[model samples]
Target: MSRFGDPEWGRRRGGRLTPPEGLGVLTALIGKQLRARLGSPAAPPARPDLDLALPDSRLVQDALDHCAAECAPDIVAHSIRCYAWGVLLADLRDIRFDREALATAALLHDIELGRTERRDRFACLCFACAGAEGARIFLEARAASPDRVTRVCDAIARHLNPDVPLKPYAESHLLNAAAALDVVGAGARALDPADRARVLATWPRGDFRRTMQAAMRREQAAAPNTRAGLLMQLGFGGLIARAPFGDTL
Candidate 1:
């Protein structure tokens, strides 16, 4: 018997321990080694030219955190890119808008897609409607004024409805145009090449096209009669064929 009080303890078998390491210990050791090798995830790249001087309110930070937790990394990155693009476009066009409201709408526009309750609600309504409701509830809880909450919800709800004119509301138009630019390269031609390159560099696409395709497929599977499903069934093929980055899908 070994001095450790077990026969297997300290026993060598071909220069290896008789008893293997515990599963928990081995897993922890592996995790530590991997972290040491890779270091922490790098901070998201900055786009100084597109900065909008966003508000420093805790409510905005909470909304951003909620978005990050509810959405996939690529989607979260896309939201950030949307905000930046919206701000840049507004600047280019000399359009005045509520920067913080647009940012809030952009970040939370897809929050419903990542939530179980919201997905359930989608059985009867579109994701945009669910997202608007979710954003409203979230903002209302954070003590946002009724008017601000309404504007944010309106921007989110109308983002996917191209037929609902976005004019008269800078936030709505900016969010719609920005999302369009990211999704299918629509409206991208209006942006300066250098601006486009900067945004892409700051938020590297990193399989976004494929991720979006998979998301659309899932939506189609879950709600075949819904707007998203109908659009995918009817227009996705054409979109894929015409999109500048369609080959990526």
Candidate 2:
């Protein structure tokens, strides 16, 4: 029935996969709307408040796909995937979250790469800036209420900087978890067991990569008959879906 495309059209004829009771449905609706606005050429380069009036999941998915298609390092792609998963996990865990804020921030958390001129720092800056840009978009979209938007924007901006310790923000844990997913899900060239072990050794308390891997392992254990766990299945699937026609792996 959607004009853009039917995300769940194949699920079952005329059967809408019902949104979980309350806030879960609300978050999904808002996410869908934001996704649509992101794809609109006329949409300003700012994040929009969850208008609540216009919640459309297909739109949000499109915007995310557009962002993911802008082409960068595999690490960046992995981060976006993790960011998406983190938002989903936070929701599934019933964490009190600003889903729109988190989704926008996660999608653009590494957008700065588009502005970076340095080859070495390009990826790092891109990753951070994209998130910052997502936050910026969210903040700018709701210029009417600068206070709240700025707070979320600030969190997205500093999430990855080891120099910028996540001390005061309430969303630090979510952001850290997102960062870890990005690192762990990065291409084989970027991370392997050895590299992951070293980082996990350094940060023993709460390592995102370690956590994602552990979570992934548990999921796989639960569904041993499946080809791959859901997170990997989705992350790798996203990567493949975004790859160019002639691209390999």
lDDT against the true structure, each candidate:
0.64, 0.39
Error of 2 at 180 (Å): 1.2
- Checking candidate 1 for backbone clashes, the offending pairs are none
Predicted candidate 1 versus true structure: per-residue lDDT over 106-225, tens digit per residue: 999877652434465432345666677778778989889887786787777656543223455678778877886687776566666667777777777666776677777776676555
State TM-scores per candidate. Answer: 0.72, 0.38
Q: What is the lDDT, from 0 to 100, of the residue 16 in candidate 1?
A: 20
Model 2 residue runs over 4 Å out of place are 1-80, 88-94, 118-138, 141-144, 162-169, 185-249
Using lDDT as the measure, which candidate wins?
Answer: 1
